[model samples]
Target: MRLTSSLLGIFLALAALSNLRQASAEVGDDEGVSFFIPSGHDTATNEDVYDLLRCARALRDEGTKSDGASKAVASAIAAAVATLPPIQLAHTDHTLHQVPERARAYLPAAIDLLARIRSFAIAPPCLDRPGIPTTTAGPYKYLIAANLVNCEAIMPYWILEVLRLGLLLSGNSMVLAGFSQNVANAQGSASADGYLPHISVYESGSKDNTVPWLLVAEQLWGAAGMRTFVVVNGSLTRQMVTDPFSGKYHKQHRIQFLASVRNAALEPLYGAPPGTYDNVVFVNDVFFCAADLFRLTHLKADIACGLDFEVWVGHKKGHMSGITQRNFDQRRRRRRLQSSSGASNAADASTADLTLHTSINQMSDVHLDELVRQMAAEGRIRNAPVKIKYNFYDTWVSRDISGKQFVSDVPYISDRRTRDILSKGMPVPVKCCWNGAVIINAAPLVNGLRFRSGISEKGECDSSECSLLCQDYRRVGATRVVVDPSVRVAYVPWSKSFHGSLSVGVGPRVPWSQVQRSGALQELEAIWNDTKRDMATDCIPLGTRSEEADLEKVRSVDLRLVNYTQMFLEDRRQPSQQPTVPRLCNLLMGPYGVVDYGTAFDDLRFAALGKNTITALTYTANSTVNSLQFTYGSGSGNVTATVHGRPFGNHSSVVFQPGEHITHGVVYYDSDGVIKLVLTTNKQRNTTIGGRTFSTNMLESGKIHQAVATPCPNDLAYAGRFRLIAIAGTSDIRIRSISFLWTKIGGKV
Candidate 1:
C-alpha cells in the first residue's frame, strides 16, 4: 500500500521528537531504517518531544477503525496528549482516509521494537548537523542509517560494486566470521598496517604488485560500519607455482605472507577492540579463472555488509586474457594424446566412420569416388563445396583426340573431363601430351608484367635480307625469321631452333662448274690488277706500279675464293626427327608414384587459397574399396568410441596427417570397435597413456599402427555410445578427431 504524506509526516515528526531518537533524529528511528530520530525543533524539550512521538505513533496504529472504534482510539490519544500543558506542537496530520486500517496496530509495536533496536545504537553526540562527515562508528549521513539499521540502503548504492572492484584489483583475499571480531580487527589493523592497510572482509586482488593487497582490504573494511558480519567465502593463499613462460612467482603471495608475519609480530597497543581476529589470514594455492571467481565474489559480498560485490581474480582492464590462455593450452595437449595412442588407424576400426581429406592427385579418384558414394548413402554429406580450377589448355588439347587441328586458338583445360574422370568408380591417369609434357612459358609472362614495355619504333631498320636477319620491319606476306607458337611451348627464348638457320638460299643449280673460266680468268685477272691499282679512291686513283701489280694478283685470288664458297654450301644437309607425344602412365603416377592415404576427417578448407588451410592424407583403394572408420578419446584411459557414416563392402584405411588443423578425432580404433572423436583446445590437452606430448616434427612419415581393445556396453554398428568424465581440478578438456579402418575378411588388427 502506498504511504500517504500525512501519515508519514506524523510518524516522521513524532520519530524526530520521540524517545526512539534524541531531540534531532528523523523518521522510523525505532525500526532501524535510520539513525536517531529527530527529537524536536529548537524549542522542544526531551519529555515534550516524547509525548509527540507517542501521540503520532498512536494515530498511525489507530489508522481508521469502524466509526465507533476509530473515534474511541482517537479520543484516547487526544485525551493523553491533551493532559500535557500546551506547548509549540509540531502537527501530526491524522487524516484516516489515506491511511490503511491495518497499520493501526504497529504504533504500539514500533515502541516495543524501539527498545530492541536501541541495543544496536551508540550513545550520541550524534546530531551535530546535516551533511557532516562521520566515521564508521559515527552518525554521519551515509552512516546514519548504516550505524543503526540492518544493511538495506547502503548495499544497493555502493557496497557491492566496491567489493567487485576490490577482488579484481587484488587477487589475494581473506574471509572472516562474525560481527564483534570483524569490527575489532578492522579498528586495530587500520593503525598497524600503514601503506597497505587491510581493507578487510571483501575485495578483488589487483595484479599490480605495487598496490599492496592490504590497502585495498583496508578501504573495503573501513567503508563498512567499523564492523560487518562477514561469512567465510574463502581464504587467502599464495600461488606457489610459477608460469613456465614467465618464470616468476606470484608477487601478491609474497606481500600477503609478509603482511601476515608482521601482524603476528606486532600486538595492538589499545585495549581489546571489536572484531580482533585470531588466525585471521592463511595462504591458499589454487588456479582458477577470473570469470569463475566473479561468481564467488557476488555470493560473498551479498552476505557481508548486505552489499552485493562481484570478484574477478584474474580479470584486468575488463579483459580475461588468463582464461583465454588456459583454453589454448588445452587444445594442444589433446592433439598430443591422439597421436601417441595410434587413435587414427582406420583399417582396424570396426564401425562406420566418415573421414575427410584435402587435395589428392589423379590416382586418388580410385577410392574417393567410392568414399563419396558411401558418405552419400549414409546421408552425412551435410555441407561440401565442389571446388574447380580450370586449366584451359588441357581442354584445348583434348577437344579433338583425332588430331584434326595440331593447335587450336582455344586453350586446353582439365574442365568437364575433371568431373567425368572423378565421377567414375575408378581414377583415370591425366592425359599427358602438349598440356602435361610441355611447360608453358610462364616466367617471361611474369617478367613482362613487372617490366615496362620499350617504346615502339616508328620505322623499321634498313637490312638487305628480311628472312635471314631480324630486320626491324617486314612487308606483309614477307617470310621473316620468327618463333613458332608450337616450338615456343617447348622451348625457352635464345635457345637453338628446330633447324640451324632461317635461311638456306645461296643456290644457282650449277651443272658441274659450267663457266669454269680459265681464259676469262686470265683477262679478268689483268683487269682485276688495274682495278686494284686504284685503292682508297673517290675518283679512281692508281697506286705505284710495283705495289699495284702485287695488289692486282691478290684481288684475282679473292674473286676465285668467293666463286668456290657457293659450291660448298650446296653440298651440306641433315634430316630432322619428327616430334611425338608422351605416354600417360609416366605423367599420372609421379616419379615415385602416388600413395592415397584414405580420407580422415576434414572441413575441406584446403580448397580455399587465402583462408584457413587444411592438410590431410589421401587414400586410394587398389581393389573394390570398402569400409573405413576410426576412434578417439578425451583422456588417456580407455575411450568410448562411436561410429559415423556408412560402411562399404571393400576394405579401406582411414588416413590423416597429425599436425594439420582439421583432422583431429579419436585414436582410429577403440576396443569397442567404434570410431571415437573428442573436442579439445589449447589449455586442456590430452596426453598419451604414458604421458607423451605430440610434436610436429616427429610425424614426417606416416604410421598405421594397431589399437588396444576395451569392452563395449553393447554390440554397435554405428556411433552408438561414448563416455565423458569431469576433470578433477580443472575446467579445460575436450576431444577433436579420430581415424581407423575395418575390413570384413581380416582379423582385427
Candidate 2:
C-alpha cells in the first residue's frame, strides 16, 4: 500500500523522539525500519507507548479481520492507539475502519510478549539493541519478526521473516539461531559448505596487489577444497587489431573489450564437455570471503547476483601511475552510510575502476562451513526495509523484470509489484543483474549464450553487454534470473559485522532443485517493446564511445534482427508441442554431419555452440576408421579413448606454426568404419594425409555453430577468413563425431 501521510508523520516523529539510538552505532533500526516502539509520542507517556505497542501486537497476532498486510498493519495500529484517545487523538487516520468486535481479547498475552522482547536488550535500539537469541540455558526458539521496510513510525511495520536465518552448529547441537549476529562466531551457510566448487576469479588493471593475492588464493582455496582458476593481469585491452595497409594497431570498443574479457574468464567452461562445472561464478574486485562464494553459489536463480556495498576505499591522486593511499579512517567508513537511494548508470561501474582496489585479500579465509554457519544464524540480510549502512552498489548492471533499473538502494528493491516478495529477503526475480558478483548455471553459457556489445551505429541499444546476455539466456529458454539479497558484499574489509547480514532466509522463494521452464518469451516481448511503452520500464542505452551515440533512438536490437524476430515470434509452442516446423535436428542430421553415436548430440547447447579445432590425432584402421584418440580442445580436455574399435594404431601429431590455424578439411569414412584424412591450413597449405580417404563427406554444419552471429562487432576486420578455434564430439572413440572449430584469421586491406 502507498504510505499514508499520517504513517509517514508517525515515522518522522518517532525517529526524532526515539531514545533507542546510541551515539556511535545503530542496532535495531533497519535502514529506517525501527524496532524500538516509542513509549511517548507528542504527549504520550512512557506507559502509554508500551500499552499501545502491546495492544497493536495483540491485534496483529489475533489476526483481526482485515484485507491484507497493509490493511492489517493499519488496523492493528488504529486499535492500539484508539485505547489512548487523549494521546493520538489527532492521528491514526491510517485506518478509517474500527477494530472488529471479534478481536480485542488477547491484550494480556501481547503484554507478556513485549516483556520478553525487552528482556535481552539492556538499553535502546541503537546501542542496546537486541542480539542473536541463544539457548545456552535450554531449548529456545525466539519469536523473530523483522522490519522489512524503512518506516520508523509510531506504528512500525514488521514482517514474519527469519532475520532470514537460523544458526547451524558444526558438530555439537548447541546452536544459537538468528540472522544478523555480532555475538556468535559464524561458520558457513549450512547447505553450501562441503561441496568443492570450481572457482573462476577475474582480475584486471587494478591499482593494488590483487594478482599476487589471487595467486595466494589459488593455493588456499585448493587447501580448502576448491578448484580455482585465477586470471591475473589478463586485461582485454591488449586485444589489438593491426591494420594490414596502415600497419597501425586499433583498440576495441570498451564494451566489446569487456565482453571478450568476461568470455575469456569462462573459456575453460565453454570449451569443456557438457556439465563440466555445476555453476560458473564470476566475482569482481570486492572484499569477500570464501563463505560469500559458497553462499552465492547456493542461490536459486539461474543467473544469481549478490547485493554489493561500497566503502570509500581510495581516491585517484594522479594519472593511475602515481597515487597516494587514503588512510583507513572512521570518516571514510562513515561515508559508506552517506550514499542516497539513486540510480547509477553503466558509467558508474566504468569509473568505479578508478578507485584503488582494497589491498588485503578477501577470498582465502572463510570456507564454505563458516559462510554456512553465518547465514544460518543470521535470520536476516541487508537491503531490506532495514538500514543497510552501505548503499546498494553495482546498480549499473542490474535491471528488474520490468526492464527498469532498481529504484531503491536498500530494504529490498521498491518495485511495487515485486516489493512484498523481495522484502522477505529472499532470492528476488529480475530480468538481469550483475552486482559485485554473480553465479550462473553453466549449461546455458556452455550452449553458447555469450555476452556481446550493442551495435549503436545500427540503431541497436548500446546497453551493457550484460543486458544482451540475459536476453540470450531468455532466447535459449534459460530464463530464470534473479538477485539474492541474502548474500551481502562490501568493498572495504574494515568491519565484518558492518559488511551486513548473511542469510539465505529460512525458506528460499525458489528451492534447490531444477525446474523446466519454457523461457519468459511473453515477458521478453513486453520488455523489448520498441514502441508504445514508457521509457522507464524499458532497456536503457549504455556503453557508448560518444555521448551522441547514446542519444540515438534504438531502431532494433540484434543486427540479425530478422532472425531474432523469427526466434522471438516463433510459434510460442514448446519444442515438443510445436507442429509446424520440423525438428531442427531432423533437418540437421546428415547435411550437418550430426554424428549419432552413444549420447551424441544429447546436449541441447550443441545446437547453438561455437567451433573447435583438431589437436592430437590417434586412429586405428584395418578396413575402416577404427580406434580414435584426438585430443581436441573441449574445454575440459576430455581425451578420446578407444572404447569398442581398438587395434592401437600408430599415433601421429599435427603441429601448426605460430599464428597458423586449421581452416577447413574433409574426413571421408566408409560403412566398414574406414577413413582417409585431409586437413588444410588458412595459408592454402595442406598437410600430407596419406590418401583422399574412402567415402562419405561430413558437410559443414556451419549453421549450427554460428547461430548468434554478430554482424557489426566493433572489432571487425576489413578482410579475414574463418580458421579453427574449438571442436565438439565425444571424448571416447567415436571417430564419426569429429566436428569443426573455427575463428577469424589475419586481417587484410
Candidate 3:
C-alpha cells in the first residue's frame, strides 16, 4: 500500500507519542528520567534536553488525569511535543540543523499550550500548592532571588553553591527565582568561554537561551524539594527606535527597564500573604561561599547586607570595592587637605572637585552645592591639603574635650572598625551599605516598601538606590540596617582565567593568589568559624556603658597644671636653636588649645589656644565651664578682659598685694548672653565694674558676679573668640598657673 507524505508524517508522530507515553508511565512521580544526547555533547545542552523531556512527561501525566479544559490543555502540550524532533534524535548537532524550522513550529505550539493553561488557570500537579507551606525539616526557610544577564558560566556554580549552603549545610528551606534578560545567542558561533554551550545550534532567532539553564536550575532545585521560578525578558541589545518626543532614533537601554524586570520577580512576594517566608535574599553578581548565606540569614536585621570585596581579575581589582571603604577614603583625604593649607579650607572651595570619588561618581550640582553649604556651616573645607609636620618628642596626651567621640568617616578606618566590631559579634550602625548580598525582612515588602529607581528629593539618582531604600526603611520605623563583614563575598568576572588566578595557586607573579591561600583565606576561614560558633551568643549592646565610664574617669583626672607647664616650656623653646620640648607640649599647642602661658615683656602676646580662635579658644553657646583655677599677683592696676574682640570692663579686674595669689572664674553667656565672673582672694576687696559694685570673696570661697558688659555682638547668638587683657593699671601682673575645665553643653564639638 502506497501512503501519502502527510499520512506518513502523522503515522511517525503517533508512534513517537506512544513511546513517549510508555516512558512517562514507567517513570514514577518522584523519579526523573534522563535523555540521550550523545557523548562529548555539551553537558549543559544535554541537561536542557532532559529538562524539556521532564516538562513533557509532567504535561502528559496531567492529560491522563483530567477532563474537558484540563484534557484540552494537556492535549495542546502533547501536540507541541509531537511537532518537535524525537528525543533520541535531539543531539546538539542535529538540533543545530533542525532548530530553525522545528523551533518555529514548536515555539508557537508551546506558547499555545501555555496560553491554554493560563486560560484554564490550573497549575501543573507537580508544582507546590500556592499559599500552602511545604513541610521541610530545614532550620529556616528562605526565598532567594537573583537577576542574571549572560551569566551562564557562573550560574551553574552559583546555583549549586547556594543550594549546598542554603539547604544541605545550613539545613534551610530555599525557593529561588532567577531572572535574566538578553543572555541568549543572537545568531553567532558560541564563544570558547564555555558560557553558553551549543548556542549556535539553539539560536532560534532569539537572543535569550536563558530558558535552558533556568530549566536545569528549576529541575535540580525541585529534585531537592525546593521551588524555582525563572523570568526571562529576552535580549535587551541595542534595538533602536525613533523617540516620540525628539523624533530621533535612540537605543532603549535605561535602568528603568532593568528595574521593571526586578520588580516582576518580586511579584510573587507581593501576591503572597504576609509572612509567607522568613526572609527574602536578593543576590547580585557575586561569588559567595556557603557561610555567607548562613551568616546573612542569621543576622536577622531588618536588612542585613554583606561586604563585597574586589576580585583581582587579570591582575586588576574589579569594581566590587566596599562602599564603606570608598566613603572613608574620601573623608580621609578631605580631612588631610583641611589640615594642610588655608586655601583648601576656604568656604568657596568646591567639594565636588574632591580627589576621592564615591560609587556614585557624578553627584547632581544641587546636591554638591548643599554639601558645600553644610561644610561652610560647620567651618570645614571641602577638600584641603595636609602639611607634613615633624616633632622631636613623643609625649602627646590625648584629651577628650567635650566627652563626645565621633567615628571617622574614612573608608579604611570605618571598614576595619566595622570588621573588628562584627568579629566580636557586635553590630555597628552604618549610614548605608550596598545590597549586593542582602537578606531583607519580608515585612518591609509586605508593608509596601520597594526598590526605588527614581531621582530622590535631594536630586540623587538611582545610583543611590540602596541609600534611598535605607532611608525609607528608617522612615517606616524598621529596625537598624547593618552590614555583616563576617559574611564575605567576591565579585565574579566573566573570565574564568581571572577567577582561577585568584584561587589556590603558587607564584610570585600572582602575589594575591599566594596571599589568598596563605593569609587572607585562612583569616576568613577563622572568622567564619568564629561566627558560626558565636551564632547563639547575644550581640554586644548598641551603646555600652564601659565607654561612658571611661570618659568619666578621664574627665576626673586634672591635667590642667601639667598641660600649663608644658605650654610654658614650649613657648620658651620656640626662639632657641635646637630647642627641646615635650611632644605633649607641641600637641597642646596644635589643633586643640590647652593653655598659653603669657610673658612679662613690654608686648606680652599670648596666641589663641583653641579649635576656633587665634588668641582665645571659641566654644558654642550654652557651653559649661566646669571649673577654672589660676594663680596670679598684681602689683598695682586692675586687669581687664575681652572676648571675641568685645571688652568686659573691670569684670576681670583684680587687686593684689605685691605677692598675693589671686584666682578668678568666668562663664560666658551665663544668663541671656551675660558673662558671669567669680573672683577669689586671700583678702576681701571691693572693685567697681561699669559703675556696678563687685566684691571679692575669701580665697577658699569663690565670689560670682555678672559682667557689666557683653562680650559678643548683640545680634550674634554664637560667640567665636575670647581674649584676656592683662593691662598693668600701674605695674605688671605675673600669672603663675592657669587651669580650666569646659565642654560644649549640648551640641556636637
Candidate 4:
C-alpha cells in the first residue's frame, strides 16, 4: 500500500505497539542491516516518525543507477533516518520530553546532497564544461568574499542588503562567501527568488545557541539554490572568560585569528580553476551599496577602491547627522568657557570643531549656516563656513629614493586640485588604497599575487599588505592601481548598541516620497545645488610643473652697481691751541650713492676728538637704500664707530695700534629693509665690545672682522640719510680716508 494518510496511520499504530527488543532482534538477523529506535521516540508525533521512515524507504526503493554514487546517497539517507525518534512513542506530545537530536545531526549532509542535486539540475550549461567562458552569457561573474564573526544580528539587515545589492547589480553571476566564526547556528536563508549565496560557518569555542538560526539560514538559502557549508569546531579546551566591567570576552590573537579566517574565505576562489571568475571583491566590515560596487567595477583597473567615510555614533538621522545641532551647541559652550577663562585653547577647539564642520559640508547638510552661527557666536569666522583645509586620511604614493613609496596623507586642497585636473568621474592613480571595499581583477591573482601577512621583502609591516600586493602587481606589469572617488562609501563602525535599523546614519538614504518633502531634505538639496555650482565655477587648473622646470625659471635678480666715488675733507689745523670742528657734507646721488672723505689735521699737529663724536650725511632725496659701503679711517687708533646705530663694517669698534690703520666696511640692506654690517681691517687685533672679544682681520688680506651691536632700524626712504658716529676712548684719533657706495637704493621695489 502507498504510504498515504490511512496506510501511514495503521503503520504508525503497529510500530508504536511493537517492543524495541523485538525490533532490534529482527534487524540483527539481517547481516547488512542495523536498525535501532532513537531514545526520544515518546516525544515525537506519529506523522513526523512516518515522514522520516518514508524518506528512507523511498531512497532504498530507488534502484542504484550508478553503484558508487547511489550507494553513497542511500547510506546518507539511511543514516538520516536512523537518527529519528522511535515510532513506538511518536504519538506523544514533545512538550514533556526532550526530542531526538536527529535533524541537527543528519540535516547538513542531506541538505548538501539536495543542494548538489539542485545545482546539477539548474546550473548553467557552461558550469559543467571546462574551458568555457562564463562571461559570454552576461556581465563578468564576481566572487564577493567576507569573514564574519558572530554577526548574526547584522546578517538579516546590513549584510543581506549587501548581498542583495551585489546580485541586483551584477545579476545572478555573483557568488558570496559569508564565513562565520563561532556562529554556525546563526540563522540566515537565501532569497525565495532562486538566488542563493554560499554560506560557510565555523563554530569554535562558543557556547552561544546559534544552531537554530544557522539551520534557518540553511533552509532558506538552500531553497533559494544556495550551497551552505557548516562546521562546528567545539574542540577548543580553553576557558572562556568574560570581563566583569565591560561584560565582553577578550579575543586572544585577534589579528592573526581574523587573518586566518579571511584566508579561509578566500580559499574557494584561490583554488578555483582558471577563468572561473573575472573579479574577487573583498569586502570588510563596512557599509556600501550597489552603485558603489558598480562604480568601482567601471574603473576596470587591476585594483579599484572606494573612499572610506565615517559616521557619528548615536546619530541616526542621515549622512548629515554627524554634525547635528547638539555638536554645535557643545562646541559653542566650550569656546565661550575658554574665552571667559582666558585660555589659549582656541587652536585645539577649532581643530575639533572643524572635523564636524567638514563632515557636514561634505554631506551637503542644509543646516550648516545655523550650526556655524551657533558655534561662532562672536563672529569668530568672517567669511565662509569652516571646511577641512587638508585631507587627513586619504593619501597618494609618490616616487621617493626607494622608488614608489607611500607618503603622508594628501592635503584636501591638493586633492581638490587633482580632482579638478582629472575632472569628475575619473579614477586617480594611487600606490595603494584601503582594502575595506575593493574590486580586484582576477588576473593579478592568476599571476600569483597575494596579500602579505608578515613583513614584506620591502621591509613593510603586515599592515601594508595591500600596498605590498599592489606593488607586486605593478612589478608584474599590472600598473592600474587606482581609487575611484565616485564610488563613495560610508564606514559602519562596530557598535554594541546598534540594532537592525535600516538607517545607520550613513551615506545617501532611500528617497521615499514622504522623505522628499522634509525641510532637511529640501535644505540638503539646496546645499548640494549650490555646492555643485560653486565647484564648477571655482575649479582651477593645477598647472603643476616638474622640479627641473621650476629650477629653470628665474626668481629675482640682484641690483647692478651704478656709481662709485671718493672724497677728502679739508685739513684743519688747530688755531690758538684750540680744536677745530669737523665739517660734514651731504652726499647727492640718484638711486646710487658713492662718497669718500679723509680726516682733517689740526694746527697743533694732533687731532682733538672727544669720545662718541657723531657726524651725519643726508641724501638729497628720500629713497629706500638697498646697500651701503663705508671705510673707517686708518689713522683713527682704537676707536669705536657706528653707522645708523650698527657697528660699522664687521667690528663693533675699529681698533688699531699706533702703526695699524682702518680698512673698508660695508652695510647691506635686504629686500625686507633689514640691514647687516660687514667689515675688514688692516691688521688682526683683539678688541672687546659689549663684553665679547673678537679678533679683527685686515681687509687688504680679505680677512673678515667681527661686529657686535644691535641691528639699527632706519627707514632710509623716510629718513633720507644715514649717520657716521666715531667713539674715541681715551685716545687722540687721526681720521684717514673714508668712502661710501650704494646701489639699488630706491622706494620699496
Best candidate, lDDT: 2
Which 10-residue window of candidate 4 scores lowest in summed lDDT? 562-571
Rate residue 181 of model 4 by lDDT. Answer: 17
lDDT values, one for every candidate: 0.20, 0.36, 0.30, 0.30
Best by TM-score: 2
Residue 89's C-alpha lDDT in candidate 4?
Answer: 15
lDDT of 1 by residue, 1-749 (tens): 12244653465344323332221122222222111111111121233223333433333334343554443332222211211111011111121121234323322222221211111111111111111011121111110001011221112112322332222222211111011122223221121111111222321223331122222222223321122222121122222422222334332222222222222212121112433321111111111111112222221110101000111112211111121111112243234323321232222111112111110111122122222222221121111122111112222212111111112222221234222222221111121122212111112111111111111132111111110011111111111111111111110101111111211211111111121222322432343233332211011111322211122221111112221212211211111111121331110100010001111221111111112212222222221111222233222322222121223232333322332222112232111112222322122343121112333443232221122211121234312222111110000001111221111211111
Poorest 10 consecutive residues by lDDT, candidate 3: 194-203
Per-residue C-alpha lDDT of model 2 across residues 1-749, encoded as one tens digit per residue: 12254654465345433422231122233222221111111222334334333433333433433344323332222233221211121232222122332322222222122222221111111111122212221221111111111111211111000001111111111111111132234223222232334555545554443343344334323322234565654423323433222435455455665665575566566556775555655655443432233344333446877676653212211011111111122242223212110111112211221111110001001111122222221222332233324456555557665555664244435455555445554456676787766767767666545566654454556667676676666556556676655455554322335433423221222221211132223332333343212222235565344532242343323323433322322211111111132322111112112222211211112212222334445555533344444443445543332232233455445555545565555454332112444556656776533333222222242111211111111223412355544333321122334344334453211
Q: Which ten residues in a row have the lowest lDDT in candidate 2?
A: 359-368
Could you tell me the TM-score of candidate 2?
0.41
Cα displacement (Å) at residue 376, model 4: 27
lDDT of 4 by residue, 474-545 (tens): 445555556544454443321111111212122222122222243433433343233221211011111132
Query: TM-score of each candidate?
Result: 0.14, 0.41, 0.33, 0.32
For every model shown, the clashing-pair count is 116, 54, 10, 27
| Alpha-carbon runs more than 4 Å astray in model 3 | 1-141, 165-209, 234-243, 249-253, 313-419, 422-428, 456-462, 493-749
Ranked by TM-score, the better of candidates 3 and 4 is: 3
